[model samples]
Target chain A: MDRATLELKKSRAFLCLECGKCTAICPISRFNNSYSPRRLLADGLFYGADNLITNPLLWSCLTCQLCSQRCPVDVKFSEYMRDIRAEACRQNQWGNASHGGALHHIMEMAAAPALKQNRTGWISDNLKVKSKGEVLYFVGCLPYHHDFFAKDFDYAPLTAAVDTVKILNHLGIEPVVLDNERCCGHDLYWLGQLEKFDELGRLNLKEIEQTGAKLVVTSCPECALALKRLYAERLGGVNFTVKHISELVAENIDKFEFSEVPLKVTFQDPCRLGRYLGVYDQPRQAIMAIPGIEMQEMPHSRRGAICCGTTNWMNCDAVSKQIQHSRLTEAKATGAQTLVTACPKCQIHFRCSQCGDESQKVDINITDFVNIVASALEG
Target chain B: MAGKVSKTKKKTAKAKFVPNIVAFACNWCSYAGADTAGINRVQYSPNFRVIRTMCSGRVTPGHVLKALKLGADGVLVSGCHFGDCHYIFGNYKAVEQFDRTKALVKTLGLDERRIRLEWVSAAEGTRWGEVIDEFVAQITTLGPSPLNHKPKSRK
Candidate 1:
């Protein structure tokens, strides 16, 4: 271990008290025994990095921050794990098929001509505006990774995104979509591949800057969070504000009116959007602005909301499924007719889990919160 | 015979050295308790040196080690009892952390007994004095630290 890393561990060890609260409450631990925040601190303190760096448990964390909240001493155990993982990557101690392996797979897919042909190829027919617009909508890796645009609801995901451009145009806001938008490097950073993260962040930042847009709007919460927090602070000099589409639509609710559709809707707070970035009210306000859509809340909504378990940061499908099942059970218990979430990951996770239910199944709507408000428009 | 007796008495006087103690008192509970002790004019040994922190959670292991390394014979960590932390549940974390540090000190062959953790509420002025008096007497009997003896090479 480096001197600085040792000193940090020493300092952190003083804060941690081996209170097994983190390990007990973690949602991922239902599947993987190796992922324990308490164990990580103890190992770091007593045994040092010889055990921590190579352990597969480090990357398995959902970064849901449940541990940090439960900690009595304010040890900041979750951030410590992140720092440890980051250090492991810094020292080139990563194993094969790391957390970012899926991201690498997706990046490879992006390079394929067949994959690139359909990905992000769809745009509004009426978008005759030039490539340079005041706002840029970064669709992120989801529309490409999940083939979301091609699958489901009459190609509505991509079309709605295009329609979003039209909606923005109607609001006197012409937004540009990057023809070659790459993954926002959140996956790489979360995976502890700092080198890849740096390379990808620089590449994405360069491409985004070329559009000359003053503001960037994203439908993906992860992409929005990464761009707004990580990219803004780390890769400075990119003078732009990153807003989620729901935030943007909520800002312009005066321009849209609801038709009183009499739908009971409940919103699931995406981990990145709500807990990580403090975006609770914007989506709710947008949803409530729709006249007849009564918004009910789950017990664990907003800050304390459960993870949807389909984080792009980790490749643990087994753990993700376990988390998904738990969250879906809670969502169904809320007695709401329709379940709406902001993140594409949350939508994908919930949809995958909801497929097996045969009876008393709640209708799962994967539409962006903004799309709902946009649909409510009288135009 | 008288000259020999005088020389031996001088040597005994030189050997009778008292230990220096540092005590950490919380602003809410322990500090007020100490103030109560003073107001009541409860006479105790002036061996203890008290430093005030906002809460018991702020009493880090580093503070303990730093005090010991800087020639404090004993360290007294006093705070509000469990569920009494003004910040709520901070003392639990503090106690847990202190226990682990105590274990580390034991492994290093240092006198972990010299370091004491106590919960003294504002009303527990008598308990505070009793704790300090007992620690001072105990440390005075234990004498100076082994760290002052000689540095050992484990390698």
Candidate 2:
């Protein structure tokens, strides 16, 4: 059998019962009737891999793993989609990349072996950090996002990194911050550029190993997922343990002394942190630790959480806008003053969805969960 | 003995590198500026290649970075002066894009001088020639781009 067929067998796509559970729950399938995970599996099974590979709908899968979570027979639909995308990438078939693929090119540039990145300029004098230590804070692509989004968006992306370090310092842990760190390659891996992703992974792993860090903490859930899971699964394995900032904060919630902010906030569970890494509760726990804070849970929370409209910055269209609009409306409906997210991309996408379109605008303040924790820290 | 001397001289000459610059010139201004320079017979460095774009804003960061990644020693984005843009505010957009592109380029460890944004009008033919000559010279001094190398064979 061909490799694509083998992937289908390995991911248990053949065991699909045509239950349409995946389709019914899919955020994309709700707005886009043409996209269905079950139908894609059936097409691969009956019509063969070629039909499945060439189909444009193949790129439409968000790979958010919502389907796999709902699948009874344990069919890893998102993993199946990832494998197929790798095949498609090998054939030079790229999806309609948003932002004219500028973000992808940035990742590729970061993958260059000889690159001497000056990525750590955001480290302010106030935050305590070390050049090498046992705990390394992986500040991934936040600086780039800060530069790229500075013009239009009022949101400061780098504040998440700064706030993370502040929270770490408050916990009496001065984490190592590397100056020459490459991207974590989460986007590249999802986009099926496995070769570049591997290159980036190897480079990042070498840098982290040099720091002698036993624990890797990241504010961005995508970076955390890549370092913790994708690196272990794809690039042999890493020496250090990876933790999302939420996990670290949650583990030491008792150590923190927070000021009374008295704000009602709702959490957006990033798919990578929630489903991919099973880190649903830690972020909520950390948020609740803030004094005088009221935590309102969205209707679709934890495993059932809807994705933040898009993934890997691909296939962003009207459906993505609608999903974002609906998600924002849901956050606003809970009577929360702020919609706090654990992921920077979530904050960016939600803010981006509110731009330009007056009719689709949902009035809500979006922020990173770390920013809240930092703000609530008692000096 | 004479051949050895000649070989040493050849090595020294090879050290005098000619930079490969990929210039994105806007059609309304910079591209026509180049034409105006040619009409005026102004002399400039011939090492740069010009790719005419509809507007300087058309040259996204992806384009500039792709050129460098594919072995461009330097990239020059030339557009209309502020308030002189044919598209009203296309040059303003170009400035914004250029700022972001420069930041990314710096983050990637390339010399920020290797990538530049300049305002040149069609009437400023001599200025166009001067920009090219100066940018090419600057890139040469900075040496070849670190990203300049053969594409690695994928595993």
| TM-score, A chain, model 1 | 0.85
* Top of the candidates by DockQ: 2
lDDT of 1 by residue, A238-263 (tens): 67888888888778879875677677
DockQ of 2: 0.64
Off by over 4 Å in 1: A1-4, A7-14, A30-34, A72-78, A87-102, A108-118, A127-129, A146-160, A356-365, B1-155
Docking quality tier of candidate 1? incorrect
lDDT, candidate 2, A1-379, per-residue tens = 6677777777888889999999999999999999888889888888776677778888888888988889999899888888888888888888888887788888888888888888888888888999889999999989888878866788999999999999999999999999889999998887778899999999999999999999999999899999999998898878889999999999999998888988999999999999999998898998988778999999999999999898898989999989999999999999999999999999999999989978768989998988999999853
lDDT (Cα, tens digit) per residue for candidate 2, span B1-155: 97788787667655767789999999999999999999999988999999999999888888898898788999999999999999999998898888889988877778999999999999999999999999988998999888878454332
In model 2, what are the clashing residue pairs, if there are any?
A: none
User: How much lDDT does each candidate structure score?
Assistant: 0.70, 0.89
For candidate 2, the per-residue lDDT at A14 reads 87
- Model 1: how far residue A75 lies from native, Å: 4.1
Report how far residue A115 has shifted in candidate 2, in Å. Answer: 0.8
Best by lDDT: 2
Share of reference contacts found in each model: 0.00, 0.69
